[model samples]
Target: MVGARTLAHLAATAFLTVAGVVATPTTTHADESSDPDAVSAALWLATEVDDNGGIPGMVGTPDWGLTIDALIALEATGADAETAQEITAALKSHVRDYNSYDAWGVPGQRIAGATAKLLYAAVITDSDAEAFGSYDLRQETLDLVAGPELGLEEGRVKDKVDAPSVDSSNTFGQSLAVLGLSRSGGVPQSIVDFLIDQQCSVGGFRLYPYAFGGGTVTGDCDEQGADAVLDPDSTSMAVQALYAAAEHDSAGALEAADKGAAWLASIQREDGSFGGSGPTEASNTNSTGLAGQALRAAGETAAADRAAAWVLDHQLTSANAAAASAELGAIAYNGESLAAAQTDGIALFQRDQWRRATPQALLALADVSLGEIGLVDVDPGPVDPQPTPSTPGPGAGGPNGQLPATGAPVLPLAALGIGAAGAGLILLRLSRKESTS
Candidate 1:
């Protein structure tokens, strides 16, 4: 019920408290990029949720969509051996049946595209056979998710969904599909092409090409005639996929990504938190996690700094706080908003925690770290072996401290994403040569 302005003020106050310093007005701009350590911490916090997002087919009493989001963030961060290995282990146990619609035996078969999501992580991280299932299963799973016969639960029927309908609402699935196929090396280029084509023009992506609803109240898509405006969650996922794919170098991809990043920046609250669009009034931890990564990716460190600071400030230091809160694991933009909700708040520990793997947030943080430390020529694998000070072990520094910065931002000449406004013209011309390689 709180408006955006109130949310901003609330965030500013809360940030000042937890950050232990008042953020200068210049520090609040969208153009600033976050230091790698803050990005790492954000992703690190999100991974704690992934640790408990259930062990796949077993049905993790608590849902795992948010955990999955965090996991994707982790992957985007390009974490080292230890971090990746830990995530890989979790995926292996809970995601062995990569294609099961209700692998966890959950009520909603298509809530967050769980099947495609696990596969994305599996393929990217190279989880073992048992964890990822047979290659044939992988292909079949992709077919099921991408094929025409989309599944819709009969129980919900008209009340929740239509029959035999593809739950395109699975934004996570769509983006992960793109990420998995692109990373798999075995999947045909066409699948990747199809996924790319699904990107909405309005600087972000949606769950499906035809599926709608992304916090839009206009009852209409954007002026570009996009099927729908971008959702913060899906848009962040799309950026992750494109960045992984290095689509930024391709025609229109960079522009699209840049616009998507810009759109994300536009929605950030004054306090640096990002709220889910529409009725979801609270600021989403998952959304904040991914948005931080996207901004970090685009070299917008200032935005990342503010956003990451806000997330850290709001993190429920207590146990199970996010889980018990009415707003789920999502954080509010500021203290007043948090206080207003505390009257009915479940528990302190349950405040900042919510359901999600947050691999993407981790990936985002890792990427920022890699960018800062100049850790190029790296491959995806265990986070520790990757050789970072933050490798998380006896000898290595904690997840924070002593990370070397790369000195200067390397702005890709090519614009990001598929939007029209950002250097798209040049990128399209370059794509003619780039795609061939």
Candidate 2:
């Protein structure tokens, strides 16, 4: 006879398979007429917002960084008007002036990266960045560039000014600065030069120039140590910045972009995904998405498509319906991690992992390059009149709901004979554990 545990396992598996298949679209065509992947991913993102418009992170409060990520993804997928308006409304409340230490709960005495990302989001959504929430995003970004304390020599943008000895900004921040400034008019040549200086010998960009332990600063264009990692995320953002600057006829930016693209192509794994170094050393969806966008921007179509395919393969689709639960629209970080999460339950770590991974993956699925995300001109005609809620509406909630804690069984025990039930459970557990471990 089939044990109770075996029956339960079979029931959960059957339910998940049916639900996932029903929820996941079968088509692979990516045109405006039919983009199932993008649409499903975007809908999943909408459920992640908290009651205060923040994404759940940093002690359960709203995180501006994650918020910007979702905004970009939603915009890329052409998400519903209601969802878009709700997110923008929440984002508007988080805006702060140039003097504030905190903007959208991202704590830094000076907010360069957060402000720059907001500026990018504002531009792409066709909102008046200059007049967004009483703070002019364009002017604020320019302030970061021109501010004597925040702006370093040779056009380097710092995260904060009080700690001059500390290197507050990394390649990611610098890249965003370049991208934001490029859109406002043009990035200064000196700033462009400073960004180019961050590239390592391998053509990949390091997340930070300083070593972690003693925080020893490395020389420009030099790798810090054996531990000094070349990150795909930083490299991807750098490529986008360089590509944008090159459009302005910046002399060395194009060459730098070409080298970065070549470096990315060289490092791609046999499975078509890209991995990171240092802290983020795993091959996952976020890194792949960033690299894919960079590759696309550099006109590396074949490599970009390969990376995109890898991302699509990792998504919770109907093909894997029988194995996964009701996470139909969500994209897993990677196959291994997804299996682990499924078996052990989706913990805080796994939830945040998907939160970061899903939006980034959406970029690749939507075929939108990072450079094109905020750089392109979008005309969102005629704003719809939304009803003002006296109290917080459904937009305000924790990252609960939508995502299932466990794959509840949805089939009858009688359907799966005793022997079949026992075998299936054993196989499922073994396969899932093997992939994760």
Candidate 3:
């Protein structure tokens, strides 16, 4: 009889081929062990903040979504004080009036789900942790979890905006709320309890109690909608938020994390990459990154490494004429093609006195590799020494919880996918609709 893992591999292979995304061998034959170097590199890169103290989004812009994710990544990397302080400065600048109602707590751009993402950043960042813990953000925060009565199906925060009603329609928003409030030092246990009650059996989370039938999601593209179902991306983020809450308090949080981790592992491609479910499924770097993080947290280091390595390789090479002609120097996400020039530019970037990508890759690689060092027990030789970038990608949050949004204040959330920590990426309204990978 095929093992569960083997069965999952077969299913994933079928899924990928049917979905039309390439599942290359490099992405498949993953290095199964903890990548201490990768983790260190990614984490170290987190500390190399921009002048504004924020990680650069794909377009080299500062955005709150990246800010929150960057902070989370910084926390994971274990950055030092100087680095942490930069993160704090950025957070302090943007979080002053972090009303959940606004996009990045600002008006104009009503992003798909900025409310909870920014709030989560504020709750976790070093500067406003105390305020996050103590402030009566109930009116703003509670609306996502439940009605004041604390029910899952109905929420207190109703989006006044006509197009996207907030109340219960926004599960992503609600998940962020649960994570932010739970991680916030000051939030009451009642809030955590409310979110927990909504967990689904598949180890995934639902937007709201009634929004999805099982509290989690399943099925193909048609049924799930654009953001309808729970893929590794949303599931990992939701579980990470839950894990953060569990770490602070709650014995069951670990158990929930374990289940989520298992579910994520079960979905790993034969080569070790994880793809979001459905007819439109494509492997996502952000999802892979988060899944690797969740698995690492669950003590599945070998499995985590496999996923991490795949993510690293997915970084756009910027090679090839077609790729060279296209936008260059940006991180290749979702299997983006690089222009030959862009690829060359990245190569040049790599050759610089400070090699940015190499180190960033190393941090996550280290975390996964180190965690699995005992599992693999083989030394790959001396790692290439690379200087950190002048401005690192997201993941700049420090231990004290100080993480600034990318250096620019009030930038659009569309730049980076999301911040490093567990905050989801912002899906900018890009004209080109790439596959989810």
| TM per candidate | 0.53, 0.71, 0.57
Over the stretch 1-437, how does candidate 2's per-residue lDDT look in tens digits? Answer: 00122233333442212311111111122333314576677667777877776566424655455666777777766665466677677767766522233322334444455566666767667688777777787777666653334333346654443432233445666777676666555566666777787788779877655554434346555745466667677788788788766644455777788788889999998867876554345566767777887887777788888887777766665445334445656666676655554465456656766776687766666655555563333333332222111111111112221211101111222122110010011111101100000
User: Using TM-score as the measure, which candidate wins?
Assistant: 2
Summarize candidate 3's per-residue lDDT along 1-437 as a digit string, tens digits.
00223234433543212221112221122333323334334443454457777655434544434444445444434433356557656655654322222344434322224445555555444335435444434234544333444333333222323223222223344456655554443334544443454455666654333333232322222334444455565565556555554434343555665677678777777665655433224554444555676676566778877866665554332232233323222233333322222345433332211122222223234442111111222333343223222221222111111111111223333222232211212122220011000
Compared with the true structure, what per-residue lDDT tens digits does model 1 show for residues 1-437? 00122234434543221211122121121222332433343334344543444212112232233333334344444433455556556545544232222333322322224444555556545563223633332453344433223222110101111233233223344455444543443333333334455455556654334434332212122432634545675566666555443321222444555666777888787867664433323454445666786687776778876766655444332332333232333333234334434455633333222222122223333434211221132333322211122111111111111111100001221012111110001111100100000
Off by over 4 Å in 2: 1-35, 97-108, 146-153, 161-167, 214-219, 223-228, 321-324, 344-349, 374-437
Residue range with the least summed lDDT across 10 consecutive positions in model 3: 428-437
34: Cα error in model 2, Å: 7.5
Give the winner by lDDT: 2
Clashing pairs in 2: 11-409, 12-409, 50-397, 51-396, 51-397
Residue 252 displacement in candidate 1 (angstroms)? 4.2
lDDT of model number 3:
0.40
Ranking by lDDT: 2, 3, 1
C-alpha lDDT score of every prediction, in listed order = 0.38, 0.56, 0.40
